[model samples]
Target: MELLQLQYFQVVARLEHMTEAARSLHVTQSSLSKTIQRLEEDLGVPLFDRRGRSLRLNTFGRTFLMRVNKALFELEQGRQEICDLSSPDRGSVELAVNTAGTLPAILKKFRGTQPFVHFHVQMLKVEEMHALLERGEVDFCLSSPPIRGDEIECQVMLLDSILVAVPITHPLCDKRSTTIAELKDETFVGLKRGYPTRDITDRICKSEGFVPKHVYEGDEPARLRALVEAEIGIAFVLESSTWGFREGKMKCIQIEQHDFVREIGLSWHKSRYLSKAAMAFRQIATDYFNS
Candidate 1:
């Protein structure tokens, strides 16, 4: 019934020579014999037909052997799968983030070094990221306006500047830079309220004396970027996220205010065990930003 008992039974059953099985198992013959004896007693049946120096499987032992072999094989497969999960070179990471800005670069860097590692990445609101991390649904979380709690551990991974992004043909694109006060009347595209970027933008705008007039709001930055691209509205975007702005149709301008910045951090539930992949990702993120 015990796994050890089943393993001993398997080795003994296969060799059909108790002495050889004991040596292969690195155990004394006497100890091996007692273990087999106990297993047979537990099953209430004899497992071997004994000969002087050799043991042969009896009819009942043969039938039981088939099922035992299958069970042992499956258990071994499970162990191998767990080992792969724990391995740094071959594993999967589950991550949630509030901003997608610096993430792709860090991920690209991680993939260059650990190409076999697979990823499950999500761009989520600040509240959603905290909830998922608390529930242990994700292994790591990258968030702006970083989350904290009794059950969570967090590290501020990066400090990113928020920039004003406008369509190439827009009037503000001609300016070297602009203040929140000067741009307050312009229509804006942004993430919805609960997102850290949205919250920060709102606070910064109010500190400059006006709530931004929203022309559109969404959860995804790409959508906001598209709206910016179409000249529908300018957007407050992370500097790292302005990747496509210059190459195609948008222009980016740095805002002078100190509040136009966000703290990006990595977080996880303190109670949840980190897989090697998640740990590697955490280190990679720290290195990427800290540099």
Candidate 2:
């Protein structure tokens, strides 16, 4: 009927004596007898045959004992899983990110130091990262900022400036730095509208009193670089995002007229309680960056 009743039936079935089972379970013999009687009454069957000073389990009691033991074992396993999820030494951390530049270092350091914690990293678009955080699908996100919402909390992790990407043969590639006005006549390959990098580019061009004439719009870093190699259009990317530019035909030019810098950071829903794994990751990330 109930878990306690099932447990009493199991113990009495095993010991084959009401007094012995109650003594083993730390209960009174009368209480244990009453519990077993209630269980048998609820099931509409006798669980044991009582002879003179002896008890033996009936045929139905053997089958029911097997099922009850299985249920009790599964219940105990579920309780242990919940305890592991709450413990700092044995929980999982789910992190979402739009860019990969800063993630590798953090992952390497955290894994090395806290080997007990497991990590689940999701490579997603800026919009996807925000939506996942809002829905509580991820614990936190590492992304470029100007992430606006009253329900979100953000901290500036690092500062990065914009770089102008152009093919080596292009005329602007020879310059060490370029202004927004100087890039007005150039064709641009921009990130999609929803991304933070694209927003930064738009803000910079607007400050210079012009909207960029985009020849292509995409979010794939590789494709953006390929378009630059074809001399199709220049692109604005973070300085760190140009890590492999020297291997390709493209060169990076620092943008000088406006600050055009973005703060990369971790963001999460303001009201969500962070799991132990997530909290440890936040502390490790902050220390690694600050150091």
In angstroms, the error of model 1 at 52 is 72
lDDT by residue for model 1 (67-165), tens? 887677557545545866667488778888866767888999889878998888887777888877765667888887888899889898877888988
| TM-score of each candidate structure, all chains considered together | 0.59, 0.60
Query: Model 2: per-residue lDDT, tens digit, 1-291?
Result: 899998788778878988899899999988988898899999999888889757899898888887886676556545545756767587777788876777888889888877888889997877778876654556689887725467788977878788889898999877899888898888899888867778888987888888999989886766888898898998887876765546569888888868878788889877555766677789988987687
* CA lDDT, every model vs. true structure: 0.82, 0.80
Model 1, poorest ten-residue lDDT window? 72-81
Clashes found in each candidate (C-alpha, N, C closer than 3 A): 0, 0
The prediction achieving the highest lDDT against the true structure is: 1
Best by TM-score: 2
Reference-based lDDT, residue 261, model 1: 83
